[model samples]
Target chain A: MTLASALIRAHIRERLAAALALPIVALAASSIAMAGEPVTIRIDNFTFGPETVTVAPGTKVIWINGDDIPHTVVSQTKLFRSKALDTDDRYTFTFDAPGEYPYFCSLHPHMTGKVVVKAPAG
Target chain B: MHDPTDPNDDPTRPSRRGALECMVWAGTGLLWTLGGGLPRAVGLERALAAEASPAPFSFLQISDSHVGFNKPANPDALGTLREAVEKIRTLPQKPSFIIHTGDISHLSKDREFDDADQILRETGVPMFYVPGEHDLLDDEPGRAYLDRYGKGSRGAGWYSFDQNGVHFIGLVNVVDLKAGGLGNLGAEQLDWLEKDIAGLSSSKPIVVFAHIPLWTVYPEWGWGTQDGARALALLKRFGSVTVLNGHIHQIIQKVEGTIAFHTARSTAFPQPAPGSAPSPGPMKVPAGELRQHLGIASVSLVHGNEPLAVIDTPLAG
Candidate 1:
């Protein structure tokens, strides 16, 4: 084979390898995003059902208010806040940090709930 | 109008004086008879005061409502709690405040607290609370409870106040509860309690309310406070002290060194008396009879010329 042809063939092989690796990286990233577990929170009446929850960091949490009353998901540590969600309304927040986060309804001081963020599982 | 000149009147004057002295002696005897039974009469008066008093002031004692609880014992715990509040409203005398001993909710759900709050607010009386093991099931000793009902309380929801010449204290014992471990007051609260009570004179009446029984009611089920002895020691100097608790969900009274310890019933559901069941959980009775088992307590204090009397009346018969 000619030396120029050999160099061109090598360059094509390297380009082919890079192209093949790109899809795999994209696939892995998408899988991680999809693999994130969803934390479910039920809100009924004047309370947050399950009052306390334990979730892994980066988990997406969905709070559905099923009660006739309105509620606010305000974190005590100021981790996050979901503005007033009325009956049948839904709110979602992602917890990226691992710590104990206590929350309450800004409207009803007596309505309290807690979220426990745990380290990601190995 | 006396005729002093008459011989007959002069002779009768000494005799009249002697008769007056005899009447005075008779009156003294009657007064001694009444005074001899004064203590017993006062005791009887207290018993009657507990039974009947016009416009008496009382504070409600509610414990272990466990709003989110749906165990076999109580399917509708919140319903029963509402019934208890209804009973409180119909009470002849409205309570001045409501003191929740603990376990206000079963799962410590925000909804449970909401349900409990809804029922409690119906009473039209201010409410005071302490934490229970069920309330502090979260990692942060149930910060939600503190944020809502624990205003003006010290760390972990302990505080003291004075009402009608009585020193009222609210203590927190469930902060570091272990699995199947008895409630604990920890050292810091004990220190605070000592300092809090140090300034009060022994003559002042003291009422200490907490979630766990300061006295060992049932050690097997972890119904007692682990460090309650230290707390009691600080209160020993008071002439009349009352220690109130609620975790056991029943009435258990003990008197030690002039301090009376009483546990109130849960407005939500009933638990079997310590060791009566396999574990401490809701106890279901017939629907009609559930109200009889679950009731609120009204504690009244009468402060007049008599000693302070605390009367605890159950909602049910």
Candidate 2:
């Protein structure tokens, strides 16, 4: 083939690869932004690990009961509540607003934890 | 270890000594008499022979059945409970009634309640009930427990009745618990308690029973009632007051002033002693030793003449 034709074909191929790569990178970035890291509050030994958590609004928070006994996540202000969570059972809630949410295990009320949800940076 | 010089140890409070005496009596299989508010350790042989002469009236205390619990600590919770019931059935004298101080079910399932009721009913003695945190685990909180046991009971299945000249009050303190606190008897229940005991003369013998220990046992394990002192204050006027509780699943007896507090063993599994383990959960024992950790309680009242007697009998040696 002629050198000029070969160079044109190589340029076309490079442009096509860039076009596909840009969307793929953008898609990955958007997905990461849309679904932020989910915060987990573990229930173990009748206590909540990290007793307090700070998260951005719309963050999904999951509570897993790792103790042999059952536990529950109940909001102090009656905003959300969970059914009894047996061993290895999980309950999840998403915080969509900026507020301090305090919760505890209803059965073992001494176990308490707080979630501080803040708005994204300006 | 207990410090004898601790200010918290009131001079008149001889709980440690009393408990030791009680253990000595129980160890010998002797029944002591509590007469005129004083405990007199009867001779072992006479006490054994005196079993034929039963107390005026007595009731059985069975607690923490946890019927639906199927764990390594105890895979057959119901089987142990039935064994406890059989012990009750074959008692030398039939108890006037039975007091089940809660945890009738593990997950608050209807089937668990039914199974417990069927097995417990074989004793053929009337029963009084108060709920435990485990029993209130239904989708709607205490719906399952209340539906079956709330009849004629005031808020959360607390009530009072007079039997054999002794006033019996069942208090419910396992609901509406506050964050960072232990068990709770909210203001409403406390109000009911005040009015319920009003008009009764100070000489009246009072028996107060609840699911959780009315006095502080182990706050770290959530084994105490937040507002229990208020209730005790109300009962302070009585000449003789006995408080029976069962959530801790072990026998712990304490006598403060005129009031005597007793916690009973479980018909299900055993829990670690306060601060004995990192956390208070079921303690798994060897399969053959499970029954040694589980048992029942018997409370006797010799009409209005004697101080109350509580006998704790284990299922096995």
Candidate 3:
């Protein structure tokens, strides 16, 4: 083949590969956005399910009261405290910085859970 | 859960209403006791002949006003509580004092406390209060409640006083609780309670008032006290010991010889019956029926054979 034709062919191939890679990169970006999405934790049967949860900083965490009685979400270090959450009620807190958070139901002291907030994963 | 009716249940881990149901099936009422050194369920015969000797003095118990609670179950907790206060004032016989079981506010806010205090002052009788879980939900632990009602109370707001020949013990059980659990009387308070009644004679009439039920009403709803059994043991020998509480927001009476456990209905709103709902939260009864379930507990101290007689009067009829 002529050198010019070969160069053009290679150029076309490189452009095609870049075009295909664009969607792949976009897909990965969306998955990362999904990773930063809010997570929900269930509080039921006098327990905070998934008692230990790890999430990226800035991710919002929601706690839903599934139990019959009223409950409160109080952080160990005074980080946050929710009002009495009745049945099906919810309390949301967004972790803005990385730290370990241990919390419990103020009403039912036996029901406890922890949250681990970490820097956004690369 | 600390159900006295079920010996099989674990003292630390209380079960469902199964034990309470058992009390019904056994032909014995859902009554648990703190009479003698042990706990047992008693019957109607166990009821002291309260009328045998006419009552000399009386006290009122009102609780859970939740002044800021604007939820559907009670749009105007303040209004209902006002109704309760009116009922207290119009009692057939004036009570010597009033004991508020607790939950005086919904969010422990200054305004809520203010509203509760403003209205409660109308009773024109001295009122004793022990904080509820709701009352302690402020920025500082019990700072608001203590500021308003903790005067002359001991550590964390617990105290004992004598009135009309009856030893009244106001215990603070909601200071430190288990995670999503019931009320707790820590070691310090327990110690104080032990010494408070150490010198009293067996014939002395005693009255214990707290925010949560001393007996296990329902574990699932955090209605009982974790260390209540221990606290109650000290009063077992007294001939006329009455335990009054209010957290369950319902009327439940039990007689165990001289020690009678009675939980009063809330002045604010009604919660679901034990195990009647999916969970224990507020219940929105038909608008007109609210008064039937929400009211005050009037306990009469008749200088007679019976130590105390508790008559629960609803807000309406």
Global lDDT of each candidate: 0.68, 0.82, 0.75
Candidate 1 residues B1-317, lDDT tens each? 34576432354343221111111000001111112112112343445434454433456687878787665566778887887788778867677788888888765678888889988899898888888756754435478888887788888999998765567899998764443346788999999999998887665777799987888887765677779988988888765677888877766655555676778777667778766765454566776676666666666554233332333334454
Off by over 4 Å in 3: A1-19, A22-35, A42-58, A63-71, A75-102, A110-122, B1-54, B306-309
TM-score of each: 0.60, 0.84, 0.75
Using lDDT, give the best candidate's number: 2
Better of 1 and 3 by TM-score: 3
For model 2 chain B, give the 10-residue run with minimal summed lDDT.
B19-28
Candidate 3's residue-wise lDDT over B148-219, tens digit each? 898998888999998755678999888777665678999999999998899986656677999888888887
Q: What are the per-residue Cα lDDT tens digits for candidate 3 across A49-85?
A: 8899988767889999875456789898889999878
Per-residue lDDT over A5-104 for candidate 1, one digit per residue giving the tens place of the 0 to 100 score: 9999999999999999999998886656544678888976445679898877788888997643345677776777775565667889888878888886
The deviation in Å at residue B22 for candidate 2 is: 12
> Taking the tens digit of each residue's C-alpha lDDT, what string does model 2 give over B88-193?
8987768889989999999999999999999999999998899999999987888888889998988788899988667889989999999889889989999999
Top candidate when judged by TM-score against the true structure: 2
Candidate 1 wrong stretches, greater than 4 Å = A1-122, B1-51, B178-180, B303-317
- Rank all candidate structures by their DockQ, best first, as comma-separated numbers: 2, 3, 1
DockQ of predicted candidate 1: 0.02
Winner of 1 and 2 under lDDT: 2
